[model samples]
Target: MKKELLVLVSLFLSFSSFTQSRESEVDRLNSIIQDETVHDTTVVNTYLELADQFYLKNPDTAIYICEKALSLAQEINFLKGQSEAHDWLGYLKKDKGHYDAAVFHFKRSLSIQKTLDDKLSISNTYTNFASVYTKKGKLDSSLFYHQKALFLRQSVGDLNLEANSLNNIGSTYHTKGNLPEALRYYIQSLKIAEKLGDKSSIATGKYNIGFMYNQQGDTAKALSYFLDAKEINEEIGNQSALASNLIHIGHIYSKSKNYSKAVKYTRQALCINNDIGNAYGRANTMYNLGFLYKDQGDLDSAYVYIKKSLGLLQQFGIKNGVAACFIGLGQIDYEKNNLVQAQNYGEKALTLAREISKPEKIRAASELLYQVYEKQGQGLKALEMHKLFVEMRDSLMDIESQKSIIEQNMEYEFEKKEALKQVEHEKEIAISNAEKKQQQLIMWGSVFGLILVTAFVIVLISRLKTTRKQKRLIQKKNKENELLLGEIHHRVKNNLQVISSLLSLQEKDITDEVAKKAIMEGKDRVNSIGLIHKLLYQDDQFSGIKMQEYTQKLIESLSNTFGFEKGEISTNIAMGDTWLDIDTAIPIGLIINELSVNSLKYAFDKERENELEIALTEKNKQLYLSFKDNGTGKKDDLFASDSFGYRLVQSLTRQLNGKLEIDDNDGLHYHLLFKSYKRIKS
Candidate 1:
């Protein structure tokens, strides 16, 4: 009986252990679910939980689990859950650098978010899309999408997200080498974060600002900002943030020629980053150390560090970083007088840099190539590479300068509008206070009747003076408008006459039927401009001429002169209440004339079904003029040569400083773009 009891107790203990193991398994599953699920606790959550469990070590199982969750979410029409699953899958694919798969899942998520009108989720999707584009070195598209996300975040009043978007925008600008603009946006983001008491965002912004300053050659300022950011991150126990700041500070010190301090900071950063398993951070620190050593004349150490960094970057498939490493190696070889090796490395780096759209890297590689060829006594090749380098550098600098100008203009306009609104608001408040005081005086008028009367007289006199001042300002503006109109009319008439005389002279010399036809076409164009000025002078309202009537008269006159009946050529003109100043109007008139003439000459070759459509619209401070004709399309090379007519059209178009696109798909479509000018009517 005692032996039997011992066996039963051992069996009971084994069964109890099995039950505990199953419970622990269940608990582990629940923990995974807890991390994966955002809000909904449904069967989809179980699938996501399973997916999370296998995602790291078992991608196939994770993918299957994700597919199951996706299917279940679709079955129940759970868009949010579906989007979440897709996002997770996309992130997983991105981790593997499967950009196509990642993009597909991200787009799926975006489609769901768009359908649901989930602004926050849509913003998140845009941010993700921007990340992909940035990785691809499509900076312009990335910036556009990031700005879209920023607008969405702002519209939704997502302050934290807005700050993130701002930071992302600064990063995009920084990549494009607009350091001052980047710093502006970064500082703005930092201020926003400080307002929200977001330590992480503040730290990130401060560090980025410091990095931008460092790139601008302000090492002292960069170090100050970096130290500030590092101190804050350290205080908050953010090891990753602190380490990033340290790396940036190291960069600044290296730029400042302080190799020892740079090495110290970089080593510290590398240790922290490695401890945290931040591969990207480790790679960056390594690169910094490589630069430090190179600057300190330690070529061997530089090569070691740079090669290590390149290996880490290759593991992550960072093409830009790899190109950078190649360029660094090329520079080292070039400095060591290894011309062949330098050229090889530089050419390889150049190829990769071009693929990755890294202009700075490309410029560096080009410079190296130029040097290598020059050293090899290949002067022509060196000169060619030098010229290319200069062209690329100038183009990049121009783009940066233009971008800066645009940003400055936008900011200035925004501030100006805000100031105007504030002034108007203050004026309203002052008027309200004055009215209240007047009412108070009226209430106590029995004792202060004379004083109130005197105040009223004084106020009346002041208002009259203000009215006179306003009238004078209005008169001055009207006078300026009139003068401008007169000048436009004068210039238009003078230009048209000059062209008419030139056409006449050309008509005398041309004997060929086609050549004579071209001269007459030129004469017709000259007449079109002359007609515009005639109409302008005929109208009492000098603000804008009536385009419909003006066009009708001009076309009718041209048809009569060309000996073509109005019914022979169909005219369809749809113009809005659009107006342009002389600068814009002359070019548009000439464009219209050219299109009309081209249509008349070539459109109705066989049958006389000459269908023409002309339309104009002003939107978004741009004027769009479109001319379409159902005619035999001209060859694409029609505008390639610099003929008299072509030159006239091209030069006029350029004078307007606008874009001109010609489409010959169906028949002929001519579109002209120019800035819209609004003239205040007197």
Candidate 2:
């Protein structure tokens, strides 16, 4: 489709290069218009011709002149001049990518031309109308208008316009993937152009034929036609056409696995496109280079070029080119043994291909995914993808069918014209009588249907209201439940706090050192458990608590319990938003509390500042907890039978199904490992 646009625009440029010499033309037209002897109609004609010449080089000037001409034509009641002015304005809109406005202007011109019985202008507007629809991707509507233009041109004996119409039809067929039909129309256009000795149309016909052959896998024939067209395009200085042909040749070479030739031609095309600032041409060449590098096993180079190509294609809304880039990316990832990445890219390509309705792209993506799944030993998925690939491949024309279609396409076109004439005759009769009867039936049917529809709507609205009310009630109940759960945690934390305070009071009254120590240790353990409920009640989400914040709070509580000032111990905690469910957080919190208490009691020196470090992380389904302190190493009898706190730490780790290791060489260091709770990614 992109090549069609470029090549077809080249054909138009051959006939429409008045802009190349617009300065002299503008001067001459102005002189003629200013002469009082000249007729007003001739002056108006000069204005329109002057505007056409200015259109490509200066759209604003063109629009101004067209409006001036239109105003004069309307003042003089010149219907033909007004229609021509409107048609040129439509062309300006179409050139500027304003399809809707183009359609409006074309239709307005069409009404004026129809009233004036100007068949030539009418047919020309029809062609303009079809082109705007083509640009809008409304292929069916485009074809209808194109056919109207063709019929009008044929009737009026406009051989050149008829040939252009055929070429336009061929381009539409090319877009629809009916290459055989496209080639037939191209051949008809080529015959007409040769008869008329129109070099531009002849070159365009050859290029279109080459494109069809290229799509059909005839590289030799396609290359021969492409070179012929390329020679003419070079002579005429049609750089866009030349660049597109080069790109096609490069693609053919790549498909045939001629890497050096592919790279040379593709890069040459890219350079030409860059010089011309042709974004579409540049993107197509880049995509080919991506495939080239991928085939050469340069995955990194392939990735960069393909990603850039995808960006450009997406910018231009070229879905087919975007899908091709995804395919290239998928292949690169597959080659690099990134199976998941490959599958992701391949699936995206498939989805885009399906969206754009390009079967070949769909087949390519499915085939790639099939290979990826096969390599990954996914037999069922591989089989499913293979089936899809086969279905799309089977739906395409095989070699014999393509040959048959090409051979019969001419006969088919002739019969189609006769069939269309016959159908038109019958359609008029059928539609007229059908409409008369349909109007009467529809009048009564609407009344009955409206009654039923209104009743159904009322019932549906009532149900919708009820459903929304129920949903709101359910949401309210869920909020109430969350609040109730929070209150329960808060009450449980208060109870634990009461117990901790009682232990603290008992420790204050105790005389024996062992009894005081036991009561203090009990209070610390109760405080650790109470902290978990406090977090549950206070946090926004009860599902999990951030380990870093929780650790900081737990360490601060330990410092308070041991009466250690900030200068006595410096704590560094770094977990970085790592979260754990209460199930895991409780045990980990208690373990850290016991270890911190032991370190504060015996490991630290009173005269020196102590440093404590704690970190928690989860990766690949494993949780890591680390605690280190720059204090006196633990005593050898720390794990003795009477060491209740150490024993408690051991039992807690066992409950968590975790392993605990100690490193006491320089300072007391404890590392814990266990299976992590299910982690939710943000």
lDDT of 1 by residue, 518-624 (tens): 55764676577677776676674543566667777776786676578759878888875655654456567777776666666556653556677888877677767
What is the clash count of model 1? 0
> Please, what is the TM-score per model?
0.55, 0.47
Model 2 misplaced regions, further than 4 Å: 1-106, 116-118, 128-138, 337-348, 372-384, 398-403, 406-682
Query: For model 2, which pairs clash?
Result: none
lDDT of each: 0.73, 0.77
- Residue pairs with clashing backbones, model 1: none
User: Model 2, 225: alpha-carbon shift in Å?
Assistant: 0.7
Best by TM-score: 1
User: Tens digit of lDDT per residue, candidate 2, span 134-206?
Assistant: 6655767888989999999999999999999999999987876666667778989999999998877888899
Question: How far is each candidate from the true structure, as Cα RMSD in Å?
Answer: 17.7, 29.8
Q: Kindly report the root-mean-square deviation of model 1 from the true structure over all alpha carbons.
A: 17.7
